[model samples]
Target: MPDTGRTMYARVVEHTCDDCVPVSYELCAAGGLMFIRWTDRTGGGKPVVRETERLISSRAREMWRDLLLGLVR
Candidate 1:
């Protein structure tokens, strides 16, 4: 069974640094909600994952674009 605490996102788009950076972000969506998942591997073992609060699909997409443009962190 699927985990009740975590909704399954059907799509995930990853944005990663080109220079072997250990950090990356993923745009994820489930039902009507969307959010960004941040992943870090700088700790040297076992990457850590964090997720932003859910947002409207459009807003999340915009945030993703802005992140690519270096507007938001």
Candidate 2:
């Protein structure tokens, strides 16, 4: 297995609510490929949703960077 312990970048967005929910994004590399994961909680932590994608192309990596920048702004 590849070393999934390394993270290339990460971001967290906290919602302005009573619970102060947090959504997280992480970009990592494993098995010589890059992947992005998104994690969020639902129903007051009763359930969680996690989505991930493999970045197979430069265009996809660029789009991911753009999205991160947009979120920061």
Candidate 3:
């Protein structure tokens, strides 16, 4: 069976961040980077969810890509 727990957790994280966050801080992110998601911590429904895919530094991108790959198995 799929890792329902992990999937649910990820979805919850996205929902909580989206619902709690305000709507003003929603920026396209700085340096071309993106906010995969943020919390209401800013009281701004800001984008709270973004990704440039290209903005991420090369090294960090590789690391995260590897990490995600590992998670699949």
The sequence of per-residue lDDT tens digits that candidate 2 reaches over residues 17-66 is 32455655555444455555554565565435343455554644665576
- How accurate locally, in lDDT, is each candidate? 0.76, 0.49, 0.31
Q: What overall lDDT, based on C-alpha atoms, would model 2 receive against the true structure?
A: 0.49
Task: List residue ranges in candidate 1 displaced over 4 A.
Answer: 1-5, 8-10, 17-19
Give each model a TM-score.
0.76, 0.48, 0.23
Per-residue C-alpha lDDT of model 3 across residues 2-59, encoded as one tens digit per residue: 1112221221112222455352122123343422322233533442333223234454
Better of 1 and 3 by TM-score: 1
The regions of model 3 sitting more than 4 angstroms off are 1-56, 71-73
The prediction achieving the highest TM-score against the true structure is 1
Worst 10 residues of 1 by lDDT: 1-10
Clashing residue pairs, backbone N/CA/C < 3 A, model 1: none
lDDT: worst 10-residue window of model 2: 9-18
Order the candidate numbers by lDDT, best to worst: 1, 2, 3
